[model samples]
Target: MNQLIRTVTLLWSLALTTGDDTVTCLYSQECVLPCKSDYREIIHWQKLERQTTVNVHSFYSGTDQLKYQNEAYRGRTSMFSDQVSKGNMSLILKEVRTQDRGRYKCYTAISSANKEAFVSVKVKAPIKSVDIKMTDDGITCKTSDVYPKPKISWTINGTPKIISPKDPQEDSRGLFSLTSTLPVQPVQDSLTYTCSISSEDSTQTYIASLTEEKTEIDLGQDITIPCPGSQGETGNFTLTFGSSTVLSYNSETPQPDRIQWNGIEVKVTSKGNIILHKLDSERHAGTYTCEKLTTQSRQLIQTSVQIRTASTVGIIIAVTVSIVVAITVAVIAYVIKKRRSKTSENNGQEGSGGTGHNGTPLDDRLQSEQLVEKRSGTWTD
Candidate 1:
């Protein structure tokens, strides 16, 4: 490796280029290093490190020659021979590896003058996520199974601050794992602490937040729930009711349907609060959470939401039942009135039938009274 490093340095020192060029490639992806020359007499490609130079590919005469190609670049490196006549001396490096990251040199010789160009290959692995927590113990940032050890750092608001990480542990595959913690200190302003991971050429961040105050809302009222830790600022946010996403808001535009901001049940306001209109017991009575997610960082508070919906609203606010009760009372009163009227009608019908108290016909009673009156003269009037 030392010999290779020296050779690379010598080649770079000897080679000349018009301007510096750097090429970025995703890990495990193919990359091409641009090198073009009119001369086909000889061609060479080498990987350059600080102290070592490793041969990558080569061509000469009418045939291919790779006897000096480094073992690391053996099968993964290739050149387009057909384009050599067009002064194209580009080299294709296949399936980029973490160890393959470095500067590469391509030199072509024709007659006696040597023409060369250099291109640097950078392998990038973006940090996908980081674990973060905020509590009485302060903040904790952690990650594991990361290729190329990572550097964890913290920022209050957006200013860089001092952060110390625990000793990193390397796994059997040479991957690294580590953790860092930042102690909590009282701050009068709304506090937002961002934890970031620097992995290779990419970065990822997670945010821990402390809200300004607790929340309280009345039942049957429209409640606008601000994202936890937002400090009352507009931003990209997501609101979750129970375990489901009730709404999400992006500062870019308005969304429709479900958490789309136009759908039923929830609305993302201009102030960044999720408005729960006409709160109901079944849907709005449970726990709620607000989260913030971005490509560089992601954070979710399983309990970020504390919706202490007043439980006293259980019985007083049954408006529909009140209407039903009023209708029922009216119906009962009408039925009683109708039944009394019917009873009065039946009594009048029985009295109109006119049966004498002794169960005799009225004509017979009159005739008896007349006969008695004829004999005793007491029926005259």
Candidate 2:
């Protein structure tokens, strides 16, 4: 009876410990088995002398089974304890990533019966810590301490695309990792691009875009378009006026314009002055652009011309009228002075009774004398 009672007590203890179980862990962080306060009680405390066995298994296989499977955790993960007493099974992981953080199970098995404890693990990565780098070729997105692994992808104006590893590599810390390179082809206008990362339990995302700088100018004047001052440099350095190539120099100077009607050829001197002469009217208004073929620098210059007419007939008429008016005034003043002198001489001859030229009478003689006197006075005074 005592032996039967002991066997029954043992079976009851094992039964009490058998059931579906779980082990929880914070993503990318350490996960403890048996949890903090979890333990199994034996029905007869004095009956069993050996510690029970606990089996811990991850739901996924290979590297995926361990916490964190994304690129962010490529070089930083490890397990804590492989095995322990039935009441104390758990795993310790280093540099826990968000994906590594999650729920795990600990199973205590005795004979054919099993008991389980479920644990929840939470993982987090702050958005503020996320860094984004944008370049002409593509963009780089990164963050630290996200567990398991995060799914990386890109979005262009709301369209989604996956970001895969350019080449797979492993760090000294034994974390799985990858890097992705994206091709950038821009349209006529500006565009925006976004990068995002996700896991089974949480998601983190980043975004950035591209912008182009532009300039404009007008025609019919003079301009200096830059050249590829150095070698082995590449860029879009174009020179155009309206739809025509006014001047174009990239790796080398281009051929001169066959038709010089609206445009003219510009010769660059050793002093860096571009000389162009007689740019006509039709090409009067438009933009001229000069840029360094290899460098990012650029400049724009504009040109315009205004023509004036001269009036010949109006000037000739004004000069002729002035000369004629001056000559007429001089003649009139001379005639009036001569008439006044003659009248005074006649009056003086009558008053003095001077002899006339013929010597006709005494009065005539006196008149003649007076006339002589008057004439002499007029001549001297």
Instruction: Return the top candidate by TM-score.
Output: 1
Error of 2 at 118 (Å): 6.2
Per-residue lDDT, model 1, residue 52, is 89
Query: How would you encode candidate 2's per-residue C-alpha lDDT over 70-170 as one tens digit per residue?
Result: 34434443332322333333444455543443345444444445455455555553232334444566755554444335455676656776655443333
Off by over 4 Å in 1: 1-25, 48-53, 60-71, 110-122, 134-138, 143-149, 155-163, 167-178, 183-191, 198-213, 228-237, 249-253, 257-264, 282-287, 297-381
Q: lDDT per model, in order?
A: 0.67, 0.43
lDDT of 1 by residue, 1-381 (tens): 999998887775464554536897666668888887766898988777789888889899855688988887778877788888888788888977767777888878766457778887776544556777665677777777666667777876677879656677777545567777788767544456677677744454334433332344565566666565444433567776655767666655654443433234676655555667765453445556677666555655433223335444545457668989999999999999999999999988766665735545566767887998888866665
- Among all windows of 10 consecutive residues in model 2, the one with the lowest summed lDDT is 40-49
| Strongest candidate by lDDT | 1
RMSD of each: 19.4, 23.1
Candidate 1, 242: how far from true, in Å?
5.1
